[model samples]
Target: MAKEIERKFLVSGQRWRTFADEGIAIRQAYIVAQDDRSLRVRIYGNGQARITLKVGHTALVRDEYEFEIDRDEAEDMLRHAIGNVIRKVRYKVPHEGHIWEVDVYEGVHRGLVIAEVELASIHDEPELPNWVGREVTGESQYSNQSMALGISEGARLHQLA
Candidate 1:
C-alpha cells in the first residue's frame, strides 16, 4: 500500500507569493466521502484529469492511490459527485529543498489558503516557512473532503492558531 504522510497549515501572509510560480487551476469533486475513505476526481488547468482514492483516519498519514483518467470520464464523474465542486489554484513553492503546494480556494471556498508539504516518513520533520501559519494537520474541518462537502462549520477565512 502506498502511504502519504503530510502536514497542512494555514497560509499566513503574502510572502509565499514571491517564491511561487503562477498557479494552476484545479477543480475536484468527491464521489464518496466518509471518515476513513474518499473517492475523488480532479481536473487540472490544462484539462488533465485524475481519479484518486484515499483511505485513512489520521491527520498525518493516509493511504492514497491516484491514477490518470480520461478527461471526459472525470467530467462525468464530477457531474454525479455528492457535493459541491472544489475549485482552487495550486502553486508550487520550493524552499529549503522542500516543495510546498499552496492551494488558494475559489468559488464557495473563497478566501481559504492552505499550504501542504509531503514528508518521506512519519518521523520526518520539514522546515516551516515563515509564511506558514497555524498547523491544521489533523483538523477535519480543514480537510478538503470536509470543505468540498460544505461540512465545515464556522470555517472562517482567517488564519488558524
Candidate 2:
C-alpha cells in the first residue's frame, strides 16, 4: 500500500524552476466518479495506465494500491471520458528530502500551473518554497485529472501550448 500525502500550489512565477533538476512530459486522463476520497484510476501517457484504489483508511493512515495496466486497456476503459485530454509540461523539482512534480498547464488549462509532492509516509514534513500559491490538497476541482475532464464539460478553452 502506498500513501501519498503532499501539498499542491498554483505556480505564481518561474521560481519553481530554481529547484527543478529534470522532468517528463505526460498525457493524463482522470475518470469521473461520484466519490472523490476513493480514486478509481489515473491514466498517464499514451500507453501506461495505473489503477488506484482506496482499500482502507484511518485517522492518520491512508492506504491505496496502484496496479500497472497496458495503455490500450486504460484507453478503452476511459474512452467515454467527458473532458479533453490536454497536453502540458511537467517538471520535477527536488526539495527537502522529497521530489516535487510541478505541472505547468498548457492549452486551455494554461495560465494555470501547479506543483505536487509525493510523500513516503503520511507524517513526513515538507518544506515549502516561496513561489507556492494557494494550497489545494483536498480540492478535487484543482486536481489534474479533473482539469482534464473540464475541457469537454464546457466550451473549449484555448491557451498557447
Candidate 3:
C-alpha cells in the first residue's frame, strides 16, 4: 500500500518562480468524486498518463494507488470523468531537501496557485518557503477532487478537452 503524506499551502507570492524549473502541463479528471475515495486520470504534456486511486477520509494522508496507462486510454477515461477536468502547469521546486510541486491552474481556475510537498512520514516537518501563504491541509474546499467537481461555488472548471 502506498501512503501519501503531504501538506498543501496557498502561494503567497511569486518568489517561488526563482527556484522553479520548467513546468509540465497536466490535465486531470475524476472518475469518482466521493468523499472517502476517488479515481483520477491525468495526462501530461509529455504524453505520459496515469490513473490514480486514492482512499482516505482526511486530506493530510491517503492510501494512493497509481498506474501508468496509455495516453489514449487516459483520454478516453477523461471523457467519461465526472464533472470538470482540471488543467494546470506543475512546476517542481527543490527546497530544503524536499521537492515541492507548485500547481498553477489555467482556464477557469486561472487565479489559483497551490503548492504541495510530500513528506516521508506524517510527522515529517518540511521547511515552509517564504512564498507559501496559509496552510490548507485538511481543508476540503481546497482539495483537487472538490475543485474538479466544482463543489465550490464560482469556480468555472471545464471537462475533458
Quote the RMSD, in angstroms, for model 3.
4.2
TM-score computed on alpha carbons, candidate 3: 0.94
For 18-95, candidate 3 gives per-residue lDDT tens digits of: 999999999999998787999999999999999999999988899999999999999989889998999999999999
Q: Which residue pairs in candidate 3 collide?
A: none
Which window of ten consecutive residues has the lowest lDDT sum in model 2?
152-161
The sequence of per-residue lDDT tens digits that candidate 1 reaches over residues 1-161 is 89999999999878999999999999999999988999999999998999999998897989999999999999999889987899999999998889999999888778889999999999888889999998989988888889888888445555543
Sorted on TM-score, best first, the list reads 1, 3, 2
Compared with the true structure, the alpha-carbon lDDT of candidate 1 equals 0.90
Candidate 3 global CA lDDT score = 0.88
Candidate 3 backbone overlaps, count: 0
Stretch of 10 with least lDDT, candidate 1: 152-161
Task: Please give the distance, in angstroms, between residue 83's alpha carbon in candidate 2 and its true position after superposition.
Answer: 3.2
Give candidate 3 regions above 4 Å deviation: 154-161
Question: TM-score for model 2?
Answer: 0.71
Q: What TM-score would each prediction reach against the true structure?
A: 0.96, 0.71, 0.94
